[model samples]
Target: MAGRAKRLRIHGRVQGVFYRAWTVETARGLGLAGWVRNRADGTVELVARGEAEAIERLIALCREGPPAARVERIVVEAAPDEPAPEPFEKRPTA
Candidate 1:
C-alpha cells in the first residue's frame, strides 16, 4: 500500500477535551502509526503515517474533534517521507 505521513497542528478547544485519546483511537482504527500529544500552547499535535486513504480519514476526523473539542483550524504538513510500522499512541505531555 502507498504510504504517507503528516504533522498536524490543531488549534482552538483541542486540549483538555479527550483529544489525545480520541486521536489515538482514530489513528488505530484507521491503521495509522504515530503519536498525539498536547502542546504547551493549548493545541493538539499529531504525527500520523499510513496509507493515503487512512491519512485522509484521520485528517477529516481531526477537523471535527471529540465532543468537547471545538477545533478552529488544522494545519497539516506532509512529512519528508518515511516508513512507519507501529500502532498509534498518546504521548505524555512534552
Candidate 2:
C-alpha cells in the first residue's frame, strides 16, 4: 500500500532548539520515513511519509514539540514529491 506524505513548515521558536533532532526521533519512533531540516528563516520544515495515521500522530505531536520548543503554528500540505527516506533524518539547514 502506498503511504501518505506531508510537508510541514513549523513556525515560532523552532530554530536552534533541537527541533530537527526531536522530529527525527519522533518520526523514527512512529515508524515513519522522511527528512527534517531547519530553514534559514527560523522555521523548521519536515517531510513525513508513512501510514496516514502515523502522519496525523506526528502532526499532533509537532504541535507540542520538545520541551524547548514553543510551537506557534504549523502549516501542513501534501508532499507528493518528497521522498520517503528510510529511518528519518535531519538534513542540513536550507
Candidate 3:
C-alpha cells in the first residue's frame, strides 16, 4: 500500500463541536492511522498516515468538519520527520 502522512492545523469554529470525535471516526473508517487533538491556540491538529488518496480524502473531510463545525482553514504539511500514531484516536488537548 502506498503510504503518506500529514500534519494538519484546522482553524475556525472547530472546538466543542465534536470535531475530534468526528475526526476519529472518519480516519478510522478510512483505515488511517493518526490522532486528533485541540490545540491551545484554538485550532485542531491532526496527524494522519495512510494511503496517499485516503490522506487527501481526510483533508477534504476536515475542511467540512462535522455538522456543527464551521471549519475556516486547514493547513496541511508533509509529516516526514515523524510517523503518525499507530491508530486513529481522539487525544487530550495540547
Candidate 4:
C-alpha cells in the first residue's frame, strides 16, 4: 500500500528523554520509513513515511512520548517527495 510522508515537530520536554529512540521503535513497529532527531531548540523533529493510519498513530504516540517526556504540542506537515533512507533512525542533534 502506498503511504504518505510527513514531517513532525514535537515541542516540550522531548529532548534528553530518549524520545528519539522511542520514536524509532514505535515507527519501526508501524513499518514506517524515516528519521528522528533532536533539534537545537530542544524539540524533536521526525520525518516519517508509511500508511496514513500508521503515520497518524505515530503522531498520536508523539503526543505522549517516553516515560519522562511532557509533550506540549506537535506540528505536523507533509514531507517533500525526496524520500529518506528506508527504516527509522535516531540522528544526531541538529
- Report, for all candidates in order, the number of backbone clashes: 0, 0, 0, 0
Query: What are the clashing pairs of model 3?
Result: none
Per-residue lDDT tens digits of candidate 4, residues 7-51? 999999998888999999999999999999999998999999888
RMSD of each: 1.7, 1.3, 1.5, 1.3
Please give, for residues 9-66, the per-residue lDDT of candidate 1 as tens digits.
Answer: 9999988899999999889999999889888888898889888889999999999989
Best by lDDT: 2
Error of 3 at 47 (Å): 0.3
What global local distance difference test value does model 2 have?
A: 0.92
| lDDT tens readout by residue for model 2, 1-94 | 2598999999999988888899999999999999999888999999998899999999999999999999999999999765688989999989
lDDT of each: 0.88, 0.92, 0.90, 0.91
> Cα miss at 67, model 1 (Å)?
0.6
TM-score of each: 0.91, 0.95, 0.92, 0.95
Pairs that collide in candidate 1 are: none
Stretches of candidate 3 above 4 Å error? Answer: none
Error in Å for residue 27 of model 1? 0.5
